[model samples]
Target: MEIYALFGTSGTGKSSSALELAYRMNIDAIIDDGILIYEGRKIAGTSAKYEKTKIQAVKRAIFHYEEHASEVKRILDQIQPSRILILGTSKRMIERIVEALQLSSPAEYIPIESIKPKQEIEAAQYVRQTMGKHVIPIPRVEVEKDFLQRLIASAQQIFSSKKEMIGETTVVHPPFTGGRIQIHPQVLRKIVLATCNDFAEVGQVLKTVFTFDDLPRLYVTLSLKLPYGRDIPTLMQDIQLALHKETSFCLNIAPASIDIQIAGLELITTE
Candidate 1:
């Protein structure tokens, strides 16, 4: 795959310019700073976060990536080598991008402001003028339908194997009143459904949806729908927030609060 890099400040509109270029040039993947930003997904493998002091969070992200690196590589290896990739990054990380892309010469450094529309008011016009439907930023649905089902099954097994609160079983506190305090399967379904609902709404807003297997590693997907009358960027921001929350879901099997695996999205199409 052809890998391209974009660099600028935090609010200099790096993403928009990259998306625009991606539309024009048919770029397949985007790297933002050290994070790989594709469609609705963003992944940071071995990248440091804003709060370096959050050691536990850092460890968690790294552990997951380390454990799954082979699986990720396996999936990535399936993609053709000549695919064009465009990445967005802060100007500070240009060196890293250079090394990663293995550029033989000075990399193409396009200033975000130069390519960005004169004002935020021009975003709609810019997006319409640039991106085509076929070239829209969206994840390839390869989450594998069975992944979530397997995750849920694993969660069920974990929960079932745990001890139930029966016969007024007490710890250091008051005794339980209910005879059967087992985790209900319905609760799992509800968690999954609620998470999916968030996914749907977020997908429509961001113009991206992610399959669950890509979860925790990369928040990936494509926005299939664009709002007609509402503010697009605002809607996108909201979806981004929801995406952050959904990606952090870790199921507590003892209480049977299974984290809903975000599989692929059900695209909203007029056809």
Candidate 2:
């Protein structure tokens, strides 16, 4: 199989632009962040972005772990796409991935500079440095299963032409950065429970499940003791909006999905 490489520094929009590059080149599959992506879906291998530490993340990305390398190689052997694109931070990194995966050397190299503008690259860098956001070229829903929900965020870019629309490219942030502040899961849960209890409609928080992948969403099951004549649907909507707003304001992070299940509702008894 023929191989092509895309090389750039970390946080340089390499992952962000991966799909567009692959589409343009007529590439069948992509080797990115230790995952094999085919037809815009992750078919095999675990993402390095899911790793907690940056060192481990790097090792995972390059397929340094034998199982990781072997799994990807197995998939590669199965599909055997004619053309493949590999993304990495440098030529050496790409070489290492190719060697570890037992693939042929890249026949062509594309620099990130050639594809992305200076301002765009700077903007990506700013987010990575300040907000610690890393973009993965996969949908947020798919990422939610494997990553911490709090650190996850989704981004979509629309590509269209006069003839037809190319469609949206999804982005996800993984919790593998070294410099970013780490918020414990308990702290986030408390924030949710506290927010729910503060609302008048909510009687008690039965359970709060925090998804740390795909925009730090919360799956909340609540017990509501509503006063008589209150609109339940409106109250639920209000609670949802309130939780989303309060979470963003309090934690400086917005949740992607807030599913509130009403476990019980009681009418206030007038004396």
Query: Largest lDDT belongs to which candidate?
Result: 2
Worst 10 residues of 1 by lDDT: 165-174
Q: Encode model 2's per-residue lDDT on 1-271: one tens digit a residue.
A: 8999999998878988888888788887888889988767787898887788889899999999999899889988898898999999999999999999998989999999999976566556655654577766766555645454644545655454654433234454556554565568788778888777777778888888876533356798988887788888888888889888887787655666789898888889766
RMSD of 2: 12.7
Residues 69-170 of candidate 1 have per-residue lDDT tens digits of: 443343445543344343333444554444444432233555565666434313322222222101112222212233222111111111113453111100
What C-alpha lDDT do the candidate models reach, one value each? 0.36, 0.79
| Candidates in order: C-alpha RMSD to true structure | 21.9, 12.7
Query: What residue runs in model 2 are displaced by over 4 Å at the alpha carbon?
Result: 157-170, 178-271
Candidate 2 collision pairs: 148-212, 148-213, 149-211, 149-212, 149-213, 149-216, 150-212, 150-216, 152-215
Global Cα lDDT for candidate 1: 0.36
